[model samples]
Target chain A: MRSFVERHTFWAIVILLAAVLFLWMIFAVWPEWLIDTLGRKKTFVNTLLNGVTLGGLYFLVASGFTLIFGLMRNVNLAHGSMYLLGAYIGYEVADRTGSWFFGLAIAFIAVAISGILLQYLVFRRMAGDDLRQTLVTIGISIIAADAMLAIWTGTTYQFSPPDWLFGAADLPIISVIRSSGDAVYIKYPIYRLAVLLVAVAVGVALWVFLNRTRIGMMIRAGVNDRDMLAASGVNVQMVFVLVFAIGAGLAGFAGVIGGTALSVAPGEDIRYLLASLVVVIVGGLGSITGAAIGALIIGLAEQFGLAYFPTYGVVLTFLIMVVVLAVRPQGLMGGR
Target chain B: MNSSRLFSGSFSLRELHPATIVTVVFLIAYPSFASNFFILQIGAYSLILGTIALSLMMLAGYGGMVSLAQLTVAGLAAYLMAILGDNSMGVMGLGWPWWLTVIVSVLGAALFSTFIGAVSVRTEGIYTIMITLAVAVAFFYFVRQNYVLFNGFTGFAGVEPPTLFGVYWRDPVPFYYLTLTVAAGFFFAVYYCARSTFGLGLQAIRDNPRRMRALGFNITLHRIVAYFFAGVIAGFAGVLLVWFNGRVSPGTIGVDVAIDILVIAVVGGMRHPIGPFIGAIAFVLLENFAIDLIDRERFNMVIGTAFLLVVLFSPDGLLGLWNRFRDRFRFRGNALLGAERVNKDDPASTGSLEKS
Candidate 1:
């Protein structure tokens, strides 16, 4: 325990806590109280839940981005297209099969195959050339987007669960609050719970794969030093393709889940692509833990910003990124 | 050692004579060939995009930073002009004249770019690219949502072109000249800057930042200044874009178009000033006619394939190909200086485009 506490990170965290306490005592207490006294509303609990739920979506997207970027140094600008495709596929499947579960499965499989093909055919050919790879992927993204627009038209597609899972749950804690003159609303969406569960499941599986499996070891090795892994006779090319496919599949899966939660529109690709970038930027590139943490922070910031200050929601996320970048160019998790 | 060996590295093998003369003649004669429509609309569009590509070239080709937000700055400028001018349909509009709006918008864009630069310049390579992308995305959403100023999804329209010397300036010939003159002016300015001390500093930073920092140059400041300079050019191009479209729409300045500019710079050859023109020509022609020839759905496929082919076969871009062919014939006299040992693989020298 002593040895663990002596770790550099532990000591720094302790120092950080001390600073936070000092700041709270010096700056926050009196002003916060005064504002509370002056008829300002505080939503500490509401914002927390909002951030966590929204963060699940971010996690779903950025997780895939991190994995692909980890194995292949190539930046797949077309990741967003995959997500959008997944949503469209899921939407169609749901419409045909009338089973949301089957729709999710079909979307995931379809996206995985397409992603693998993209990796093997296009991305594989453009390895070791970052500029060319970026340009090509960007071109592919534009094509994909145009094709989607052409096929889907410029309409926003939405999805909702069956009657059994239609509405929110009113727990005793929330129902009990209604006794007061002022009514407090506390209805939790089950879809959010499903997303939260999927994020956890994916997280655990990813952790196990990277830590316990031989292929996972290779991926970890590849991220750290591809040249060394190649020198060690590992098939670096195969790893890149597998990593890309898996990452893309994750995004597709997330898209299916996210589509049910959020509307899958024509321009959602660009928005989610930017979200992925923000995740990778704040969370160190290729770090799953970083991606998770970054997604949570950004997601929550976005949700609360929307709820509290609708006009400045986007700007708030941008500010967070800019501030984080100003302080740490490497990110919250430093890049290798 | 041969006398030329010591002087060879110092003096460029090809002199700057024919290329310069040709460029000057082309600039002078371009407007002559422009019929009313070609002169005013197409010509102006080409020049505006070319100028934007010039600023992008300075960053991508010279500074080695691929920025996707350059168009966002242009969009912001356009939005600012609409929001600040008297003729604007926007809420909270200052209703200022076109002149004041232009100046203010340009300044706003410069400030935004500088802020982006301040954060992005701290990192190198792809990190800088992603950082700028985040900034662009954020600004895009901000403008898309806030209805009072940006008009939400519906952007400002009816931005009339400037009138000077009693001319409405919307006519093809006058607008053509306006864009051509500005493009020419910016072209020379960038060329001169590239030839100046600042240009050398930028090149040094691009080639080796650690060494430049070791040598006591303020690398961040140089990068930020480059971004500022680029933003100013983009801002001007934005003003022109509104004039050309007769309106500004969020759809027009989307991420796709931003990426398109980067594509143009790379396709034309990030190495040379003339590369953007070559790229712009190809792009404009492709955009105008490709949909008719192939399935409109597959138009991007053609562009993607073209970008991939260029990058794989010729990193120097189309202009680089022209230079190589020109060099093959121009240096035929001396066996040592000629085709057998033709060193056309160097990207920097390709952009330099040495003349004989």
Candidate 2:
């Protein structure tokens, strides 16, 4: 970290100044001119929070996608299907058993098992053939999507979080100063904050697992050279199965969480799939840190675009992707 | 002598195979016997879709780049035609002449495709698919959201083909012939280009980009040019598609339709130019008749299963399966004919398989 700052002093100074300005914006009462130009401080803070939380959700979906692609070189076009299926399964279980946490566990396990079946039955046979594998996944997604529609129909279903997570929580930051000279604190949803916390925990855990653990080391090595990893007496296929299961499980877990935050419907699969694809593309393929940064940028761009330009919101995300492709085709964190 | 042969090769009827003559005759005479529904929906629709899929096949099969944005390119042309020409929506219809609108639309789509290609060509292999798919989805969302220009969700309707030479072109018979002519023109264009220097160079680059680069070829330029050629074909098909449907909507260029184009190209057999048409005909037939076998909503399931089976069993699709069968039959025939005959057919069969 120190070396990064030292080597790129100009960039470091720019980042530091930006961070300080952001901190000031968050803490200080906004001037009348600022509020006139940028709207209420409440909306600005809420948009910022929403974007961060949305980024957390995107990170959950894309990290798994990047992991599988990093290790196995499989694009898994059916991943969006897995997410929708997970949400559907979670909704059903939660509705039936009345335990949202149980539903989450069940969704993860169910989707992970399906991932194993996919790896074993479909991907295993055509291993190392990227195009064919991608095509097969597309076929699988089409079938799965239709089959799901047959079963679930077109209705949107939203999950009910626990009573404790149902309402908003007040934060320390002041949104406005009332005529009485009293500051009014900002209120945000508890569930979204929890989701953000969980995402951070999962990300740190993933970093530790990949960087410190032996199996994680093996997975990293496999990503670099599968043949060499296998030849070195490691069970490479076993490692692949493990990675696929975890990657798929994260998607399933995120689906339940996302379904709660948003809603589950027929077209949500395509939405999340697009999200993961764009995230990975901007962040760089096969990099966890890249996915996180990519997701945050996309999420913020989307929320702010919606708040500011409403009509051309989608163009902002697309412009970011095009710029990234033009300037850094390998991605922000992706290795060449 | 070689140049003369090359010139005559594309035009000579005597040099054409017997099957080609029969097919052309059948197509020219199709409108007389076929019903209006069959002519417009099955025949003309298939031809337009096949032409669009052919653009994808040209890029994927020959260039070794599988892009999911071909339909998006076609969609842009459709939207351009609707916006620039006449439309009932009264949004941005400039009431331009049909010929000018078509020329502009085609050029617009080609330039858009070139831009997409330039951005995508920075990466290699599987990245192409992801990048193109994202671009396709982005276009879908953009058109659906921007109301001032694109008309948002409702889109443009009552988009009619111009009447020319004292005939209403949108009528079933004329439309069928128009589409057939265009499809056949592109079909043979792709066929001829496959044997031309540019196409052969593309195939060589697909096989070994490093070696092609070592040989002083401009790899990126070759690919971008391929994209421009494909865009023209897709752009023409897009114009025809809007005229056929009499409308252009965000739904017309949805992500599902994009994938369907890929499915058609893959299912038909990407090895040759004829593959997309064969795939499109089969797709249109199944789409029109799948209700007889199963629920209309479950057609995706059936096609998806068929796609899975094709990918699993024969990656080169129906053409590969047919070629294998013929090779086996030819081997048996050669066993009885002569060992020298077997040797002559060997390289041809292997060469065809290696093209993809």
Candidate 3:
């Protein structure tokens, strides 16, 4: 961090000033002119919070995508299918067993098993052939999407989080000062806050798992040089299967969580898949940090665009991606 | 390489293969015998789709870039034709002459495609697919949302082809002829280019970029130019496609249709210009008739399985399968001839070599 600031002092200072301004905007009671120029403080805070939580959802899906790509050099186009499948399975399980957590667990396990089967049966045979592997994934996604549509019948399904996680909580931020000179706190959904918390915990856990653990070091080594790792007496195939399972499992888990936050249907796979692609592209392929940063930027852009410019919300995100590609083709956090 | 042999592959009637001659003759005479349904729905539709898929094949097969945005480019042309020409939507139709509209829409789509190529060519290989897919999806969502220019969800309709030379061009026979002309034009254009200097350089870059760069080729410019040519083909096909349907909608360029284009290219074979047309015919036939064998909803499943099988067993697609089968038969014939010759020379050795 110090080295980054030392190397790019101008950028660091600019970022610091932006951070100060942003913090001030979040805390200070807005002036009448400011409110007239932008909007009510309540709307601004809500949009900001929504962007952050949505970024959390995007992180959950894209982190796994990056991990798989990093370790296996596999694009895994079927990832979106896995997400939709997980959501469907989660919905069914939760409905039957009367437990959302159980459904989440089962969804993760089932999807992980499917991922393992794919890695073993399909990808193993065509190892080192990147294009063929990606093509096979595309084929699988088509079949899987059609099969899911047949089973689920295109109905939108939203997870009903438990009663405890339902309802909104009051935040400490003041939205407005009433005529009586009393400040009104902003109220936001508890479930969204929890989602953000879970995402942060997962992100931190992933960083530690990749950096501190022995297995994590092995995985990183494999990502850098699979042949060298194998030559050094590592069970390269086993590591690959394990990484694929975790990656697929994370996507499945996010499917259920995101389904609760939003909703799941036939086309959500493509939506999330596109989101992952853009995030990974902007954030840098195969890096968890890159995925998180990309997700946050995209999520914020989406919310802000939707709030300010309704018709061109998607274009805003696309413009960000184009700009990122133009400036840094490798992505924001991706290494050369 | 001899310069004569290099230039020998240019399009010329005298050099046309017998198969090419037969195919052209059959196509010209097809409408006379076939019903309007066969002529329009099957023939014209396949040719239009084949032309579109041909663009994808040109990029994937020659340039080694599998773009999912070909349909999006086609959709852009279709939308431009509608918006710039005339539409029933009472939207922003400029009511330009059909000729003007076609020229503008095709050029617009080509420039758009060149821009897409410029953005995506920053990355190589698999990243091409991901970036193009994102761009395609982004365009879909944008068209679906923005009503000011794109007319939002319900896009322009009542689009028609011009009546030329006292002929309603949209009529089945005329449409088939029109599509056939365009398809054949692009087919031979791609065919000739594949053997041209630029195409060979592209294929060389696909094989080994670092070496090609060392050999002093402007690899990036070559790729962008390839994209421009592909865009031109897809743009023309798009104009025909919108006319065929008499409307343009967001659904026309959805992600599903985008994948369908890729599936068509892969299944027919990406190795040759003729492969996309062959695949398009098969796809059109399956799309029309698959309902007879199974539920309409299961069509994707069947196509997806066929795609999977092709990728798994015959990566070069159906053309590759045919080549392998013919090679085996020819090898067997050669072996038999060799055995006979050996027998004439030495019977004992021939027995040892021929028993199997």
Question: Per-model TM-score of chain A alone?
Answer: 0.86, 0.98, 0.98
Arrange candidates by TM-score, descending. 2, 3, 1
Candidate 3 lDDT over A102-204, as tens digits, reads: 9999999999999999999999998878888888999999999999999999899988889999999999898899999999999999999999998999999
Q: Considering only N, C-alpha and C atoms within 3 Å, which residue pairs clash in candidate 3?
A: none
What residue runs in model 3 are displaced by over 4 Å at the alpha carbon? B1-14, B333-356
Query: Global CA lDDT of candidate 1, please?
Result: 0.78
Specify the highest-TM-score model's number: 2
lDDT of each: 0.78, 0.91, 0.90
Candidate 2, superposed: residue stretches over 4 Å from native: B1-14, B333-356
DockQ per candidate = 0.47, 0.70, 0.57
Any residue pairs clashing in model 2, and if so which? none
Top DockQ prediction, candidate number: 2
Better of 1 and 3 by TM-score: 3
Q: Supply candidate 1's per-residue lDDT for A268.
A: 91
DockQ score for model 3: 0.57
Which 10-residue window in model 1 chain B sums to the lowest lDDT?
B347-356
Per residue, candidate 2 scores C-alpha lDDT tens digits across B202-250 of 8778877889999988899989999999999999999999999999999
- A274 in model 2: Cα distance from truth in Å? 0.6
Ranking by DockQ: 2, 3, 1
| Candidate 2 A-chain TM-score | 0.98
